[model samples]
Target chain A: SQTIHQWPATLVQPVGSPLSLECTVEGTSNPNLYWYRQAAGRGLQLLFYSVGIGQISSEVPQNLSASRPQDRQFILSSKKLLLSDSGFYLCAWRAAASYEQYFGPGTRLTVT
Target chain B: AQSVAQPEDQVNVAEGNPLTVKCTYSVSGNPYLFWYVQYPNRGLQFLLKYITGDNLVKGSYGFEAEFNKSQTSFHLKKPSALVSDSALYFCAVRDIRGAGAGKSTFGDGTTLTVKP
Candidate 1:
């Protein structure tokens, strides 16, 4: 069984503050990772995805970035957070052979 | 561009009644469709998928979906609705032969409310 763990379940910060959300998959290696943001009562928006380490693909232009430093580790970072960046952030992993994606618990961010 | 459309913003059904959440997709190549459920403030859970073969696929939580090639629709259906079945449902579509995979286009999720 595979499990994805996301840290800092809830965070509140002021404008221009740094942001870091970490995600790690315990039971899988070399899995495709993705980052998505969902506004309150809205649909999901794809932010970034990585196929391998040091490789990140940005789906939409925003104040966010993603990095896969290790086989099972994925990190979402931002130099400075914006008010619009506040939302529910999710980290997901997809196996090489399967199209189904498994998502983590998600981090609730609030920018004050 | 591959895309998915969930026409209804919400669907209301009474417990013990049949329920149907509609989903339609558009893609250039072969379509890979999926249905997901999301509880309040939680991550999306995969319910069912239609990759190939049988048009009817069964999945978790007593949910099933039927794929119609001519209609270009993959609708989620259940014979009986439960009060616990209330949640947000999303429809997703992917083109198997497209430029890049690991990316699926999703529709604006439909809120399914099962009343007791």
Candidate 2:
């Protein structure tokens, strides 16, 4: 069975601070990773997706960026956080041949 | 461009009654559709998916969705509603032949409330 793990389940940061959220999937290799943000009562917005190591496709232009440093490790980072960045950040992964995505527990970010 | 639409923002249903959450999509070529459920403050859970073949797809928690090609709709249905079934449901679509083949476009989501 495959399991996805995310760190700092909840985070609170001051405005203009750096942000880093990590996601790692065990039991799967060469999976498609994605980063999404959801505001209160709003639909999810895809921020970035990576097909392979060092390959990242961004869907929205914003203050966040994603990286696939390792086959099973994906990281979402930002040099500086904005107030608008406060939301629930979710990381998901899908098998290379599968269409359904599995999501991690997600991190609740609050930029004050 | 592929897109999904969940017409209702919220759906109220009484327990023991049948429930249906409407979803419609637009995409070129064949569309891969999916349904997900989200509890409060939690990540989305994959309930079911329609990649090919059968129009009726059954998924976790006794939920099923019917794919209507002509109407371009994939509606989630349950034989009987339960209070625990209340949650946010999302419909998503992906175009296999488009530029963003693996990328899915999600609907705004519909909140389902099952009353006792």
Best by DockQ: 2
Q: In candidate 2, what are the lDDT values of residues B63-116, reduced to their tens digit?
A: 999999999999999999999999999999999886869899889999999999
Score chain B of each candidate by TM-score. 0.97, 0.98
The count of backbone overlaps in candidate 1 is 0
Looking at model 2, give its docking quality level: high
Candidate 1 wrong stretches, greater than 4 Å: none
Q: If scored against the real structure, what TM-score would every candidate get?
A: 0.98, 0.98
Model 1 per-residue lDDT tens digits across residues B7-42: 999999999999999999988888899999999888
In angstroms, the error of model 1 at B115 is 0.6
Q: What is the DockQ of the complex in model 2?
A: 0.83
